[model samples]
Target: MAAKLVTRCSLLMQVLVFFLAVVPDAFALPLNRLKSLTVIEEVNRRGPYLGLITVIESEENAFFATGAFKPHKTHPFVDLSGRRFRVGKIHGEKVIYVRCGVGMVNAAAATQQILDLFDIKGIIHFGIAGNANDSLSIGDVIIPKQFAHTGIWDWVNLYSTTNLSDVVHLDIASYNVPKGEGTNLLGHIGHRNEEFYSELGKPNTAQPLFWAETSKHWLHLAANLENLNSTMNLSDVVHLDIASYNVPKGEGTNLLGHIGHRNAEFYSELGKPNTAQPLFWAETSKHWLHLAANLETSLSNGFPVIVFRGLSDLAGGQSGENAISKFGPLAALNTAKAVVQFIKTLQ
Candidate 1:
């Protein structure tokens, strides 16, 4: 009887040890615990995680604040801006609208912060871009069929020069130039290219004189000429120059310019408050490439990024002074509308 009792006592001790090894300590730190173990603790410590949506813009004029809407009763509007403003939801969807400040630095910072703070699934960068191509006009929208970083060219070029050209070729599919008397006039100008010039007895003397005289009347003539010259093919180059020459004085609407890093210094000299430049002002495709790269990085890291642009100005060699008066407000309104529409679509 004593032996049997002793054996039972030994078994009881072994059972206790086994149970202790299998069970987790209740008093362990919340963060130090493994995910599976801490899930219960997390549930106790905080409520269920919420879905996230982010909206980014360079400026306030590009976006407007509508009052908050709550789709989920439990998750109230959380004001990220220290009570001045609340991060609210769009009507009928699980969305949090945020105003990401201007430039790639601001945009990237804001995006990182939002991701760190919330469980964001996607981000949409809706704002304005100057018309890089003549096919796009003021109020026209661009939804990057492909994205590239204009800034990364040097880095990529260091390894492979060919890669740089390939990137530009991929990122920019087409641009929408403003449609107006300017377009029509420019069309006429294009007809006078080398092909046409050769066909019409190479009217070099007449063409140069006409271009020089028209340059005095039009502020954008110089830039237009530069753009015409830069196009890969002569046909496109000639066509663009001719088009600029023929655009009637009062035909096209203007868009605002948003300054990217490339043209900021030059535009700063214009004495205008540092505002966004229009599409026409953006002479180099480099800025768009920069924007595309930055956004692609964010998107790769589980963030949703969308780029929305309003044709604000004919950026290349055109005066915002002339275009802004006619199209500034309209462009702003159009941009705002696009943002709102994008939000609604999220629903």
Candidate 2:
């Protein structure tokens, strides 16, 4: 009887082993089939926002933007991943307003977090920035159609030559850097394209990207907001024609050829249109604004992005002392108004 029992136990053990190997799902826990939950999901009362309003910091520009934001009745603020996102409405459109700290990394991280944790249909990043376009003035706002990352550059050795197309080699002699052995420490600053790598079969291959364009559909919507400019209290010098100030040489042109084309070769090489001519201000691009806009467009996959920048300072190009302090609030307010107006136009 003992021998018979031992044989029966061995046979049962073999059957169990075969069943476990062949049909593993039969004994699997239900937990394995559960969907992964995001932090916003765990909170139980968060997003599904219509848009996200991102700014660099909360001191000046952000202050104005938040003031315009009307919070939701139930659960107005949601704190997650070290960010205090204001769940609110801008111009009746549901939005998540957050200050994205500062710099590229901060902006990128905050943008990604909001996207991952919420259902955002679009983004509107607005703030005051230094003005590179002379045609625009402090307190004036601009909405660019596209953006580029111009900060990433190659500092070539002094006197070194580059023959690459679309590369800008700007000599830095006027800045007055240290002179080492009768030569500046670094040569010209080479403006190169933003480097990108493919995630597919050619991960090692580098691709050059110049501009990140904003959504044309969003841009078309923004066009309706142009009438808002008529109501803004802008500077008298706003969109002032620099050519008018130039002394004409009597050949139906100014003495300096075109005041805006002082660096015509530079603009030509970069493929930027000259803004010296009348009504050519539309082609001008703001620097810091471009960076923020490009960042938003690059990180977003499902949502459209629009950027608004109010010219606060001349980016060190002003004739007198920097006017950022005096004009920052006005610039910030102007952008806030534009953002609100833009939001109303969106569906």
Candidate 3:
């Protein structure tokens, strides 16, 4: 009996040592421990943030809040899981800022992380976005009232026997399938899961909600900013049109001086007197762009979210390469300015 007891005690001690070595600190901590072994502890130290600001790219952050508004000099960033959350004051409002990285997935993850870790009232996502609208200029700021996740979908398998007639489907096979020896997809099917909320009691099953609407109160506040004060002049607009149309170098003449003095020598060499003017550019109310990019990661987060996306590139809708490389910084800066002004309006 004494020998068996000693063996059991030795085994128990070894097991306890192994368990201690294997278990993480988070799980090993006592129930009474107040300090957390997670991002919550790291964030709570300098948090109770008024709002959370999210950006997409490094350049966007550089021009947006990093250069203009500026993060706090002392412990500016809270590095958590490879993401640097910039803790700062924008217009005297305590805010936590972070670059959401690029794409909808990155945006969703970062937004969720901020919401989970920090004590923020709302989310304000701003970044340079691809534009397809002709009326909106490169540096224009667009505060979309509604945002949608159009990228989420199911690529229907051609071989599958699933009948999806009731569902919204796009038949890609109808558009001539490539004759090459690769597998071809027949169509794309969309999903519309009911947004069930325990607090709301019943999910709104009226219609499939594709668009996630932004905060109306935030939109109302943003509308009061200065209007039609775009820094881009007629000259800049005209030059962009020239690039978009890809007019032959010698064929086009800047007769109206929209793009500096007309090349008199070139016109003389071509033996054509440039008399006619091209109406390539027009002005619209610069308060806000009517359209925005399709990225809506934060809009569906169930929190009060507002987005201010600066028109960066034309999304290859233009003739040549994308214009983001040339004007992205400017666009980001413009949107940042709008966001700063908007934050000032908040109480």
Candidate 4:
């Protein structure tokens, strides 16, 4: 009986030893007494490092896709319209590319989503805008020196009535769709008529009569720019002259009649012509205004954002049939290229 009891005790000791041997080191060892604790702590306390730059496009195909970055994930694309998100690499630089869709609301939403989901250092909005100013041609690129939310007060009450006393000096000018006028061309000036006419090979006649009228239109545009500068506190508003009003050659007379006489003064006097309404359709600026507002908010939050637009149509009702068909897409491509170039500069 004594020998059996001793054997049992020996087996019990062996079982305990086996169990301890098989246990994980983490559980067996006291975590508080680990020698590598300091190393792990150091790794955990690392500071903010440079992250990948993100480029977002309103259209998927609008993206140039030549950069050094590759799409980080493929499982679920980031999109509002189920449009697949694509990522590519350019020179070891990471670019997360996604189509945010068209218009201001989509652009703003996309910007927010990208900011929330990724570590984006800067944002570049690359798209096409109808050139409200006539001097702009089909493929000219415009880097907004300043953004104006035109006619802000006309529709919404952004600033409170109580704070009306605290006038936030707006640097940009606003346009009010003049009252009772369906398409009164008042308040509107043809700043780029001479440039447009010049491009059309119909430079204003050198005759004194033409020069005086042309001079008036030039002064009018100059005055408008000056007023804009004063209000926006910007020294210079940079605009590119692309996109023209090209009526079919045979149909020129009819279109010209609709646009009124060829004189620059006549065009300038016809403020906000219904014909030009499509290009300046308050909807366009509304789209841009949302973007500008979001950008302003982001900037306030200490993020850097820039907007780049290519002029695709003359804001005035001056687009020729061919201009509508060809220049629009071409202008968009040029804008995309410019965006690509601009991104490279950021790196």
Best-matching candidate per TM-score: 2
lDDT of 4 by residue, 1-347 (tens): 99999999999999989888876664644443242343323322331111221223432344453332344343222332343434444444555555555555665566665555455555555555555554434455554433433323322233322223221233121343554444332222111111112222335632111111112232233233322222221111123222223433234343221221211110112232233321323345343444454454344334555554555555435544424344455555555555554444445
Question: Considering every candidate listed, which one attains the maximal lDDT?
Answer: 2
Q: Candidate 1, residues 1-347: lDDT per residue as tens digits?
A: 99999999999999999888866464343333343233333322343222232223333444443333443344333434221112335555455445554455645556555555555555555444545454445544444423323232222222222332222332111222552322221111011111112223334532211110011112222222223222211110101121332234456543433322211000110122232233311124323433543454454354445544544445443633534345444444454444454455444
Please give the TM-score that candidate 2 achieves against the real structure. 0.64
Task: Tell me the RMSD of model 4 versus the true structure.
Answer: 19.0
User: How good is model 3 by TM-score?
Assistant: 0.63
Which 10 residues in a row give candidate 4 its minimum summed lDDT? 206-215
> In model 4, what lDDT does residue 40 have?
26
Q: Estimate, for each residue in 109-226, the C-alpha lDDT of model 2 and write its tens digit.
A: 7777777666776677767777655455456677766555666567767657754764566777535545443545556776777665423325577667666566677777777676
Report the error of model 1 at residue 169, Å: 12
Off by over 4 Å in 4: 1-59, 65-85, 154-290, 319-324
RMSD of 3: 10.8
- Residue 104 in candidate 1, Cα distance off native in Å: 2.1
lDDT of 4: 0.40
Model 1 stretches with alpha carbons more than 4 Å out = 1-62, 65-86, 153-290, 320-326
TM-score of each: 0.43, 0.64, 0.63, 0.45
Clashes of each: 41, 1, 0, 34
Q: lDDT of all the models against the reference? A: 0.38, 0.57, 0.53, 0.40
